[model samples]
Target: MGASRLLVSGIACLIDFDDAALSGPPASAVPTVRSGVDLLIEDGRIVEVGAGLPAGTAEVIDASDRVVLPGFVDTHRHLWLTALRALTTETDLGGYLESVAGRLGPRFTPDDLRASAYFGALECLDAGVTTVQDYAHAMRSPDHADAAVSALEASGIRAVFGYGFPVFSTARDLVDIRRVRERYFPADDGSLLTMALSPMGPSYSPIESVREDWKLARELALPIAVHVGAGPVAQRPIATLEREGLLTAGTVYVHANSLPDEELRLIASSGGSVAIAPAVEAQMGHGAPMIGRLRAAGIGYGLGVDVVTATAGDMFTLMRAALVTGYLGAGSRPSPADVLRAATLGGAEVLGLAGRIGSLRAGKRADLVLLRADAPNLLPLHHDPVGTVVSSAHPGNVDTVIVDGRVVKRDGALVAGSLPAAREALLAAAHRIAG
Candidate 1:
């Protein structure tokens, strides 16, 4: 769908906010839905959004019974682990580490990695998630890393390919990151596909090892993502990291459910972001969800579909889990609009992409999703549209998916690739790797 001009006409509800609200000026009022609006997309960007927009010489999409929203952003995911889906459903955090990491990780070949990455990315896009942060921790070799990156590039999804270094890895294994950076992402200037470093955090490795990885990330000037606060050590590791002055704004701490408020404040002041995986954390016995503490500390937090092994990968499930767990923890319900923000703009801020793809502003790349409002589950929408989306809508209701103004899914089906072929590839890879 390159070089196509598409006009989405008569949109029932256009949900977005002003880009100026992101500049940290005096906050404007919350964004509201504009009914009966039309959006004109040309050259892979939204050119106009208002009433009476002409659709001259442009392909038109009928959105009279759909709610158009900026595509959901997933801050953290292990896209290479799609072949292991549902195998770890009954396993908790410890079992996962021992089984998935220790046993299965060492067996994956480069071909397996590529197929899994492709299938995982397609699943995410089908669920209306346009952007993702793929924490690929199974990079067993330089070839494996290259294969994973190539698969993501081929999937046509916007992603941050996090080059993973496990605690058991040697320094020589990580030497290829520089080459990978230079080969794939030579231009460090705001490309849609960027590079990140997934270092083994202090919780899983020694302080010296953590220092080594963090130093490499700083030298490359790339973002760092690490797992923290899932075990019983509490905030001791974070306190030590703070004392050593290793924390920076590029750090993205995951699973901070057990952390105290003081540490959350420290992360915010240090300009770091947090990724809370409610479903995985709850299923795996990580402490109570920290939505209340995170909000009180004023930290920029976003939801993540941590692992497909334990939970669903769709943002709808993530949004619903965040809403329910957050309500239970805070003792006060969060608005549906607020939940949607966490899924979209909040995730963008975590990935440092607030100026680009979070909302449906005029100049932003047209990454959007159209949900069928006439579905039985979404019928009888009398009150808040956002509320119905958060509490009721599922992935099956996704009728159209657009990323960078290209139609990826039309009429509720993917525009490219056969689902059966993708599924067969995943199963074959899993059998070969897990055998």
Candidate 2:
């Protein structure tokens, strides 16, 4: 009667994102088909996958009308900015900075950050996003960063906590990096909550500061992500970083909207990955990112929602926007399946967690979402399964979600976290900060 209260069984269709795992171009597995597979989860790792299991194994769920998929992994976002929604609706990049830097940046109380981070987290979970890379740049105070992580942990969402500059500034402050490392990177589970030092880069921080941050990241073996692309007015962060020897295997550069062609190859050579938030880039006037060229250059590329300000958290929407817009930019050459690859497995590659999560294989983590193929807007299913997921699916169609072998959502419901309180708290925080 209350929240299924049991283990789940039965699976109708399992569309593995492993469509091109072995053929070369950073592929997923294979055989995306109507699978009558049964999943067994115990102590977190996926214990079994294949035909039916023995009777009375646990609880049984009727999954005949559902299509299962791996939970979406979002590579980048400022989840804590959930409270400060659209403060720059009528402004540009400078305006976004002025508003955030001057007002909301200094006003992010612990409670405010907690509320905002939780609010954003709820949206992602509701839309079937299992993992999010949270760039909490406004963490001026230690409590602020702690609050953000606390909110994420409380939300029961998996995350990579990007320990960034305080108040979104580029300047480096003399803070306790070890404290941050110890707090998030617990020895028990090294993968869940990670500590990544993010600098403001050339524009915000001095070249020395950026380089120092890179060195520290390298020493700690933590991946470094920075804002690149956006435009050509200033030396693009990617080129500047490459020239400075900061672009290394540890670098995970974000954006590159207006980067030159050769720069993509440079990125690949440097062993860095590219994160393309196509929708946010277009809306924010950064022009189109060269996704096709980046892919061809053997650089791992993934999609980002950026923030709730300019894009939705649903990876499907981000993937759809990228598919159509990138095709339009390239005059519709790449197949929609290629776009889906970027969203799922490609993203997994960028995050460096491809083998364990990402796709639905026997040994992979059972992170998946169940979408309703029979929705009125969805109509007849004639197109490619991945294409339909990319172009047509929405959060509403995500009827169920499984993360880390646990049912996080079932029958259009959430099994972790709450939004009403988050919304209320963030709303109050915004008004208080603005006032």
Candidate 3:
């Protein structure tokens, strides 16, 4: 008798979006080959990757003509906007505050928070996203933070539940950052769910208030993510933070879209990472030289699905929109894999969690996406798989999603049942806000 074999389903295309050890971007930025390959996932990590394995000892997922990629990591998203989608798309930043984050944010009861957060998470999961840097910036009340945390917990998604200062205008309206740190941060076990200080930053927050929040994070050694260049664009916060010697690696400067080359070089030199929300930037009149300058500084850079009010929360849209906008605007174009990695590994680096998540390596956590290329729209794989993903694909192509060895989505459906009610909760909130 032959040795017992494990299931080895073959994929027509496999793109490993890691390992670019070269002077510039490698030709195969994401390694690929159009050959029969089967990924044996054991205890969650991919155990083997080759062809012709014996069978019968493991379950099989026949992905003969499908594509596989790492699950997306959304570095910047206002998950609270799940309840207020497109509510203020027509409005400017002030209008956004008054309409959604101000009015709708205040109206969210804890129940409403859970409903929207959990629902938004499910939306991401069903679309094959396994990780999130959720900017949960709409804590109407302190208890709403609990609702936000609970929503991430229940969804089985690996996320940094950004513990934002209570949604407010003046820094005085902000809650005690100290209390938020001590009470709501999920700092146990260094596990999937953790917290980052997401103070509204110097624009919405006073320098004094922003400094206070930074103090709490520094005291706790917690990473902090701050929104920049999305609003008044008055001062380059990166330069300001650098001058104060606060632009350390743990400081993630998001949407530095309007900042120029000089400012970007300063951020890169200061060891701070940047997350460009290109779609939201263009949609909001944030400005040109958005992602291009950030990349040129030899600084760490990533992508994000920022501010769902003016954009969709899914990463696919972010990738496609950014890549096209970037290539069309640049002298040279980044390969699709460079684009993909920006959304995953690049994003993981932005959040300062690169080693634990992001890739499909042996020691990394099992965070991945399975696209059913066997589907009609996915058939006829002509171009590169990574290109197909960022170009031709949508959320519907996602057949399964895994996060930290757990299957969160399968067969184009969310594993959690509460998602429906949660979706309804958002619909109801929109109506109430409208009235």
lDDT for each candidate structure:
0.82, 0.70, 0.70
Q: What is the clash tally of candidate 2?
A: 4
Clashes of each: 0, 4, 0
TM-scores, all candidates, are: 0.94, 0.90, 0.89
Please name the candidate that would achieve the greatest TM-score relative to the true structure: 1
Evaluated against the true structure, the overall lDDT of model 3 is 0.70
Model 3 — which ten-residue stretch has the worst lDDT? 19-28
lDDT digits (tens) for residues 1-435 of candidate 1: 344798999998777755565532112125568889999999888889999899999899999999899999999999888999987889888898888888887788899989998899999889999999999887778999899998888788888899986435554465798989889988766555899998777777777777888888888878898888734433465776788778787588988777767777778788888888888888887878766667666677778898898999999998888888877775345567767887887788888887778898887888899999889998776577788888999999999998888888999998745668878988999989775
lDDT of 2 by residue, 1-435 (tens): 022222334665666656345323453223365556766655445566667764354556666666677778888889987766655555665666677766567887888888888888888888988778888787777787778889887877767778887644545553555577766774525345556666666544557777788778767677877777534323666677768877677466788766676777777887778878887777777666456666667777778888676566788888877876777564224466666666667777777777667776656665667787677756655456666666788899989877776677778988777657776887898788875
Which 10 consecutive positions of candidate 2 have the poorest summed lDDT?
1-10
- In model 2, the runs with Cα more than 4 Å from the true position are 1-10, 19-31, 86-90, 166-171, 188-191, 230-236, 330-332
lDDT of 1: 0.82
Return whichever of 1 and 2 wins on lDDT.
1
Better of 1 and 3 by TM-score: 1
**In candidate 3, residue 97 scores what lDDT?**
63
- Candidate 1 accuracy as TM-score: 0.94
For candidate 1, the clash count comes to 0
TM-score, cand. 3 = 0.89
